[model samples]
Target: MIAALVSAGAAVPVAPPGLHWSACASGLPQECATVSVPIDYAEPRGDRLDLAISRIRTAKPELRRGVLVIIPGGPGGSGLNRPSTYVKKLPQSVLDRYDLVSFDPRGVGASSPVSCELAPADVTQTAILPWPGPGGDISPTVAWSRRAAAACAKNGGPVYDSINTRNEARDLDAIRRALGERQISYWGVSYGTYVGAVHATMFPGSTDRVVLDSNDDPDPALVERGWAASYAIGVEDRFPDFAAWAAEHEEQYHLGTDVRGAYLRLADRLDRAPLPWPGANPPVLDGNTLRSNVLNGLYSDARFPQLASLMSAALAGGPLPPTTAAPEAALQNTFAVLNATICHDVSWPRDLRAYARDVAADRKAHPLTAGMPRNVYTCAFSPGPAEPPVRVTPDGPPNVLLVQNLRDPATPYRKALNLKRALGDRARMVTVDAGGHGSYLDNGNACGDAEVTRFLTDGTRRDITCRG
Candidate 1:
């Protein structure tokens, strides 16, 4: 009767407004569609923008329950490639029961992509990461952040202002409506966990089953800056995992057998005398660059070997590994959105003297990350207009499931527990005795994956404590 009334051209209610899908350029089984959402939800009828959406339908049509939307990490992360990644990891039961959906959030990949056109010198990991100079000088990063923020404001257009967690959550709902579903399930990781939490709170009834892996503190006041500050402790907590690995394989890659001391000393040594290498941007491998690379590799345990090998080669004076650079346009888009989303999400501390004091203290306390963790991003200098952060509380449906590693280098266990406590009876917390950025399929923790899969499939919940 509802469909009849709508199709008969009568004023009727329906979702997704107007959705048209066809073959996606990915050449995979996934079909892609463009969704239109208000640029400003406050003025829903004023301006609209396209949101790129993709879906991989279930093989068993009869078993299809609803949609499972996978939210990607990073203020700049893209989810369009997630279907392919999930094909290998998600259990067959999940594949049969739900149509998997993922999207590149607003001002991100293929969807009114945002760009700042930041200088090439400032684009690489070391430079972008805010590693201090020998004098512990972070003035450059502050200056850089100011300029980068201005560049984004200039090149990013209005869409840059539109890129944020809340808007992204709104975009997910728009996608859900487009798919003709009254409610949707979510699996969000790292930064996505925050996104999922906000979505659940904002549209409590619209969220069915939510799995927030590697959760962040939704302490509305701190927001992403809290996540950034925790890296000091986060890196401290997880560095032991890397240290233990280095200790076990001392013979293979011997910077030293001292586990932790070796990497530190090597970093110090490299800082003074950086190794000259060919084909690398800035054309040299300095201590800061090496540390930045190590930080990136720690996100996944599998990358440890490559990171260790690089350290060994550099220490042993062997060949330099090939360095790949993303096209300038792509890099600009990523940084632009990253800056816009982070700066626009919440206000950050702007006092330069305070940062200096914190940096000095952090460098002394957590040498693993140095002062980089507390270092400013573009947010500190150019905290663009901030949306009131969504206050996450246990006011929604009791359908949230949080999976977190005990020692995540980015989100950390303590932060996860904070969120878990905030959720109270509305969610179940599953703790994994592991060390990595992502907890489920990305890590080899079978228990964590099983818990998540069971929750999604059976609608069951129990707080689980599992082995790595």
Candidate 2:
């Protein structure tokens, strides 16, 4: 079941030999290795690329099930270091039964690296997206997209050009083979959910106990570009959650007593004259910066206080906050892989005017986001995708459980439903009334987590919805 003929050319991919695990000195009791895979799956016998892998074998091997991979989010996310953080979170039964494993996907983290070597100006986080000018002008963004594409073309070399999600699915198969598992389970979140879905579509027999959390829409025609636009409505749906949180503690933050008014006022002020935010990537704290930070911060409830404090400091006129998220190397890797997957997945509307119309409309409808979601980006100008998107369908292996939050701003609940409907009878969904991006030991309620854990631990399937 290498390639069941979806869209990544007529060629199916193949995996290299299984792993020879080596000792690693990390916080978690784990071993790391590299699995060789074809850089171009179309030519399985062609040049090879190494994908970094990590594992924490169950302490109680007598009770072992099979390997369960944790596919992280961000087409560029690395789960190699996640087990240490999540060691205490998993139930004893899960810990005893499965080896928690993860890896840095190709062109990400410790895997073979690729880069556009983007200049500082273009590399700025906000600049990475197509940001319209004060009067809704997109000329600058269009120019940047062209320039960025040229840089990627010159510096990304071959591997960067080849980094598409379809190949990532092939890479997942390679990882499975490397682990010597005839069939493996998955705990995939966000973009990883999309990878898991496609892997199932491509290799149905290789899957077991698949849990896709915070799903991506498997709409073959739209793909991630549709996801890019969906964020507008998502922010609209998700803003109230943050607003209410801020309003409840307005006296403490003192931005304003009226939550909506306070947030809007602050944003408006910043747009008029961005505060001098040093050490930050873009360096100036503008409305979109606040909005971008807010959008990211809204992913989990536990980080709500951090957003509040950042806003409080900004409103009170303090020095710039720290600028530390992903290191520059990882950021470079993420930026490259994210664009490679998105732009390569499907063709976006090529006309610039189409973007202008959408952005203007989105701004009016969702001012907190200020049309960012609907705006164009690097993908709009890439040399097009390497392969046509592998169409996703409900035809696949069973025991697939989808746990989604009702209000995920990044991977919105509505988008997840699209995936649920796409999977059809192949999957049963558990919807949580929570308001965050992830589920199953991340942001979901106990009822939802138990549904996933129980299914993984004992193959129990009770398709149910959980209230907040």
Model 2: weakest 10-residue lDDT segment is 5-14
Q: Candidate 1 regions off by >4 Å?
A: 1-17
Candidate 1's displacement at residue 4, Å, is: 29
Query: Which parts of model 2 are misplaced by more than 4 Å?
Result: 1-17, 25-28, 320-326
Per-model C-alpha RMSD: 4.4, 4.3
Clashes of 2: 0
Q: Name the lDDT value of residue 185 in candidate 1.
A: 87
Span of ten consecutive residues with least summed lDDT in model 1? 2-11
Put down candidate 2 lDDT per residue, 13-47, tens digits, no spaces. Answer: 23444578877546457788898999888888998
TM-score of each: 0.94, 0.93
